[model samples]
Target: FASGVDFHSATAVDMFPHVRAAVDSGEVLLEWDGKNGTPPKPLVKDKYASERRKAKTLNFSIVYGKTVQGLSKDWGVSLGEAQELLDKWYSARPEVLEWQ
Candidate 1:
């Protein structure tokens, strides 16, 4: 059960603190479904909610080796917007970018 737990253990131990600090300082908000009673509530409403969601989708797509043109079509954003979003994400998560 819960495969990949070992694979991610190092990241959980090392990088989670940084992520938690960002959440605590209001620099980022964590959101998830509450159906399972875990992460039972939404974080603060972001003013740029739509843009953030698009950026998040692009981030995940990048992790899966998606190209910019594919991400543009998948997110229904222009190529420029997708590229900009990716740039911002890479800047924000340089460590993750390096690992990728």
Candidate 2:
């Protein structure tokens, strides 16, 4: 990882306090509400501890060169929704995309 972050039990999103805060606060819009399709809505908080899984999926997904279609399938969402999430995540962490 560009940040060189490591974890033992939980994903970085759940393991790191700052990462958890960022995710919970919508600093990283990984947690989304898929029920609303017209305009995918982003959930500001990971009330059910979903952000950790999303962050973990994104980290490995990005490294593996996953496509928007792949993300769409992986997250059970539409391509546009997946692309939107990737755009937001990349916008929030340009350094990660730059490193890639």
**All candidates: CA RMSD in angstroms?**
8.5, 12.5
TM-score of each: 0.47, 0.52
Q: On residues 1-100, what C-alpha lDDT tens digit does candidate 2 reach at each position?
A: 4443432113545434676676577565434335656324333334334555666677678778999999999889999998987786676567777788
- Which ranges of candidate 1 are over 4 A from the true structure? 1-42, 45-56
Where model 2 places Cα greater than 4 Å from the true spot, the runs are 1-48
Q: How many clashing residue pairs appear in each of the predictions shown?
A: 0, 0
Taking the tens digit of each residue's C-alpha lDDT, what string does model 1 give over 1-100?
1342221222222224554455567664454345667453334223334444544455567789887788678868899976765675566557776777
Best by TM-score: 2
In model 2, residue pairs whose N, Cα or C atoms come closer than 3 Å (at least 3 residues apart or on different chains), thus clashing, are none
Candidate 1: clashing pairs of residues: none
lDDT of each: 0.53, 0.61
